[model samples]
Target: MNSSESNENVKEASSIEAIEDEDPTVLESSTSETEVDAANTSSSATEGKVRKINTETFIAEIFDYKANPTKWVYKGSKPAIIDFYATWCGPCKRVAPIMDELAEKYKGQVNFYKIDTDQEKELSGSVFGIRSIPSILYIPLDGQPMMSTGLSAKDEYINQIEVNLLKK
Candidate 1:
């Protein structure tokens, strides 16, 4: 890749690494950090299902990224997986069923959520600095949240959950 592309990758890397720093969650999808619209949010996302989470729900359940940009503390009783995807993305479509299966498999053990890059622009682009689709934010019950981009096998997700989240 060119230098500019490489630099952009570095920025994205830094954004993801910020999660490791303080485990923050600010999905600056499109607009600037201060431009996010904080609509009414609820944390009523059902478990064991691939639920689509809006920006508000994201702030409520996962992290109040708008309010706390510098530090992110997960507000969930269970481990979580936030899948960043788009309706038009082919690879995202391919990964959806796998996520669904994994969600059902984990059920009460892990919470699975999908963030639409097209719908939540500020979240996908700005908060997370996601330049591509199928980026996953794996949040453990404690410690730092791990980021995995691109598509992978179902076993990989299982491994991530078993090793990363559950420490199994």
Candidate 2:
């Protein structure tokens, strides 16, 4: 084997070792919504809110649908909230921080994600049928997503999530 070939082999071996050494409990620690829910239920029942979802998993796990014409398909164990907004929109800017706050507060219960309409134009406009800024979609595990437009209050979002998603 040549020098370059030996280097490639070493790189591959190191990559494999890294994957093998990864802590198995990391998934249970950060990704498991059920565990978070259980802890919230037993401890701080009222304050539990929105869970932050990993971006890659959000795309892979959640089903995609086109706007007006297409329907949402939810097949996950936990419910989710998908925020459709643009950077330039003023109201969207207002709601962004609230979304972030909820993401941390509800770290394990409900998965949350934001899709930039400006960046993901076809996705926000054509796919999700978002005609306005700050359109929030609440997707329960079994049912269709409930769509709400405009700048909603923090309590309103929490109430909808609790009643429709978490209560189930």
Return the top candidate by lDDT.
1
- Among residues 3 or more apart in sequence or in different chains, the pairs in candidate 2 whose N, CA or C atoms overlap within 3 Å are 50-106, 66-127, 67-126, 67-127, 67-129
Which whole-number lDDT from 0 to 100 does residue 101 have in model 2? 85
Q: After superposition, how far is residue 87 of candidate 2 from its true place, in Å?
A: 0.8
**Candidate 1 per-residue lDDT over residues 52-141, each given as its tens digit:** 778878877778876767666778888989888766667888999999999989988998888877688877777777765678888888
Location of the lowest summed lDDT over 10 successive residues in candidate 2:
9-18
Candidate 1 TM-score to native:
0.74
Q: Relative to the unseen true structure, what is the C-alpha lDDT of residue 113 in candidate 1, on a scale of 0 to 100?
A: 84
Per-residue lDDT of 134 in model 2: 74
Candidate 2, 1-168: lDDT as tens digits: 333332221111110012121212111111212222221132233223433332234445566332223344554566778776665667878988898788777767777766665555555544554556677777777756666667767877777667666862
TM-score of each: 0.74, 0.60
Where is model 1 more than 4 Å wrong at Cα? 1-45
The lDDT per prediction is 0.69, 0.54
